[model samples]
Target: MSKYLLNKFLFTVDRDPELVERYRAEPRATVEWWESARANRILGCHADESSTWLCFEDAEREALAAHDYPRLFELGAHPFLTLTLFIAMFERDHPPLGFQTEYARRLAHVRLPYPDIAT
Candidate 1:
């Protein structure tokens, strides 16, 4: 596991309990990112029991480190496609800028999980 992404968060939108079930009842949408350097694929995503579950490769909790995590976390949220940029940038045990203190404050909620990527 990448130290930068120790948390594995699986997002489920459970606004409408029936929505989740309905989403799962039919075919799911497949999404891919063009910016991805490797195979970053979202097999399927749909709602069930008031929740929309996204089935992804490995970005479930890894996305928590996203600088955009907060932005992507608002209600009525949808899954994102930025793992390509993340996997392409992170190095083991380092955030590129190292252990930054200021970013922690100014960008606390908007910090990129891997500063090595788009800092």
Candidate 2:
């Protein structure tokens, strides 16, 4: 079982179904979705190099850097923590930090796209 309460990725985003719709509308969405878990992506493809990335759930940086263990209690340091932090950062003014991929065969150098849609 997970140590922290993960706000289910799919359900949380499902509150806005357009996200999935937009993903489908996109030219390509390279993901190995775990359908059993409501399309939770097990492995995501890096848009740049097609590198495979493990998916993390509900992890964050400030929640960690502050040594805020209590808040981080919910953000487990699993191999997949990289992807989870992205969710916790949703709608935040700043982009995600403290996320890293461990075993991507083809690592890609991705930069933050300006004019964030969430803003």
lDDT of each residue in 1-119, candidate 2, tens digit only? 22222333333333445644443343123122322233333334333443243333324434332323234333443324324443333324334432332222112332334112220
Error of 1 at 106 (Å): 5.8
The candidate that wins on lDDT is 2
Q: Model 2, residue 79: displacement in angstroms?
A: 22
Q: What is the per-residue lDDT of model 1 for residues 1-119, given as tens digits with 9 covering 90 to 100?
A: 22211211222212334433332332122012211211222325332222233233344232332434333332112223223222222322356654233324443555334233220
Backbone clash count, each prediction separately: 15, 6
Q: What would you estimate as the lDDT of candidate 2?
A: 0.33
What local lDDT score does residue 21 receive in model 1, on the 0 to 100 scale? 39
